[model samples]
Target: MSEHDVEELKGVFDVLSSQIPALIRGIIASVFSEEAGREMGKAAGAFYKGLIEAGIPNDVAIRMTENYISVFTNLGEIMKKLSYKMEREGKIKKEAEEEKGEEEAGERAEEQ
Candidate 1:
């Protein structure tokens, strides 16, 4: 390949490499948010139970339950986003592998 072609390929690779960190961060954030939400729900339930045993008002207990439900709902959304991101990443990796295989096949053919 010509020097110009090599430089162009390198530039493209550099751009892809730079974006990798951001992609990974988004995926991690999505997963962690979901996990944290689950933990929060458990803690909130325990708190509500304690409050009830301690003779807290019915209104206060209802409000606490609502808040916990809201947190779980938000967590469900985050998990959905994470699932989509992971699926997209899987497709990208599969395509890359296929392209690499084709390139290797071409090189072998040329050698023969």
Candidate 2:
């Protein structure tokens, strides 16, 4: 991908990062909210109906929808893992710098 593509991809991830918490909250609410689940079911049904009406074969439509959802959700999952890795690396780097600073202070005290 070109540099511009990389940046646009990063923007997608930045949006997901902010929405992750709300997504989690929705998941939790769905457990106790029958209306929410029913609404989502209706939405899915409409999507399939629309696809069939568009002349896509039944089997192909189902498979296409499944693939689309799988890949889209995996994109967010991939970003979550990447963000976790970057955060872990940042913590490790911070700790290493702190230790180095302490060692330098110790050496200076000893030299005096």
Candidate 3:
């Protein structure tokens, strides 16, 4: 190939190499930002419509919202702890069963 074609190919390669990851990052960030914005908008609209429009005091609404969020966060923490406990219990049960099986096998071997 001619030097001019080689140079053109290098230019294209350089652009793709530099731009592809940047484009991907931009797209990912845009998607995440859009979704987050949509969620916040929906939450805000619901709060405004339900509480603020219903003539609830703005300070009361804010406090209620914070309390509501705290409740959910606490619930989430409780659920997480329960989930971990269940998982540990499951693992312990499995290990105990395995040990029992090993002990039974050992007794059979001794009998033989």
- Using lDDT as the measure, the top candidate is 1
| Candidate 3 residue pairs in clash (backbone atoms < 3 Å) | none
For candidate 3, lDDT tens digit of each residue in 1-112? Answer: 9999997986786565555545545544553476755875677568656898889999888887777555644654555555556556656655786899999999999999
- Compared with the true structure, all predictions reach lDDT values of 0.73, 0.69, 0.67
How far is each candidate from the true structure, as Cα RMSD in Å? Answer: 7.8, 9.5, 19.4
Give the per-residue lDDT digits (tens) of candidate 2, residues 1-112.
9999997986776566555645655554553367855765676678778899999999988987777555645655665566566556656655786899999999999999
In candidate 1, stretches whose alpha carbon ends up further than 4 angstroms from where it belongs are 1-54, 57-62
> Can you tell me which runs of candidate 3 are displaced by over 4 Å?
1-41
- Evaluated at residue 64, the lDDT of candidate 2 is 73
List model 1 lDDT by residue over 13-104, tens digit each.
65665565457567556545767668766887887898798898979987977886777567667656665676677568768868999999
The local lDDT score (0 to 100) that residue 37 gets in candidate 3 is 53
List candidate 2 segments past 4 Å from native.
1-44
lDDT pick, better of 1 and 3:
1
- Which pairs clash inside model 1? none
